[model samples]
Target: MYQDEIIQRVNNAAEIENSNEMLIIRKIEESEKPMELMLNENDRISDIKIRKLVDCIVGRKIIAEKVLLIRDHFVSLHDYLDLLNSGCLFDDEYDALFATFGNFEISCIL
Candidate 1:
């Protein structure tokens, strides 16, 4: 799954950087509003996978520490997925552009 792949890549990068912390992704059925809370009062919440939760605590820490490489990687992955879901992958122009970076293959069984 794309989510698992993203989590693995982020965790691998974190491990290489000697950061033992890892983020967790959760799915909520229904909620009035998305919120982020620490698992415990003493423990810091690295990332919260709630919808529409702006002002991520961990994201701020990453930026504040100036870890540009990891940040860029995550941003790029997010943008690529967004574009792909928006049907940009089917467009010849975008397909060629993405191909220049790497081969992106999508196979479907219909």
Candidate 2:
């Protein structure tokens, strides 16, 4: 019974880790979606996606510009992975450090 319980605990931990990994990947894809739309649409981005991007960048001033660079009124996806790893991706403090990257503002919407 003791060994069975130990095995179960280990399995549960592994499952949790795997779930977190998948969650991070999904969030990365979700946050990058706005920029992805822009790339395929000749630099034209969806307003909704831009809002999503903004939600992902708030309070992450350090990495904001690194993940996204805006110049001459054009926005480009920089280190996209940075956006994925930012704590801003998660709204809960318990899950904050479970992931990792930005500061950004919505100036010119294109």
Candidate 3:
């Protein structure tokens, strides 16, 4: 159900069966200079999510359309323990992350 050569396989299948699916794709030959932004501890989790969204979509011909686009940065025990002491509740953390993802999906659809 999953293949990396999706486009080519789909195109070939369309040719074999003469499918009427219109896959309108234009090759964008544009290149962009790499940009950088520095983030500090003061940045909110939502800001971090927006930065990740920029990495996913801006100036790219192909994109991975998945909800779980960004990975967790603070995976170690020390990270959570520090946040634990800093008073970031688990429910609030979950709410912020999911809310960001929901907004990101809506933005992409619109």
Q: Cα RMSDs of all predictions? A: 19.9, 15.3, 16.2
- Indicate the worst ten consecutive residues by lDDT in candidate 2: 101-110
Residue runs of model 1 more than 4 Å from their true location after superposition:
20-22, 31-110
lDDT per residue (tens digit) for residues 5-58 in model 1: 888888788868976576777664553333321122333223342111222322
Q: Count the backbone clashes (under 3 Å) in each candidate.
A: 0, 8, 0
lDDT of each: 0.36, 0.39, 0.41
TM-scores for every candidate against the unseen true structure = 0.22, 0.22, 0.22
- Residue-level lDDT tens digits of model 2 in 53-96: 64645645544342343222223343222343444444453133
C-alpha lDDT (0 to 100) for residue 26 of candidate 1: 68
Q: lDDT of candidate 2 vs native?
A: 0.39
Error of 3 at 61 (Å): 44
Worst 10 residues of 1 by lDDT: 101-110
Number of clashes found in candidate 3: 0
1 versus 3: better TM-score goes to: 1
Instruction: Spell out the clash pairs found in candidate 1.
Output: none
Top-down lDDT ranking:
3, 2, 1
Report how far residue 41 has shifted in candidate 3, in Å.
39
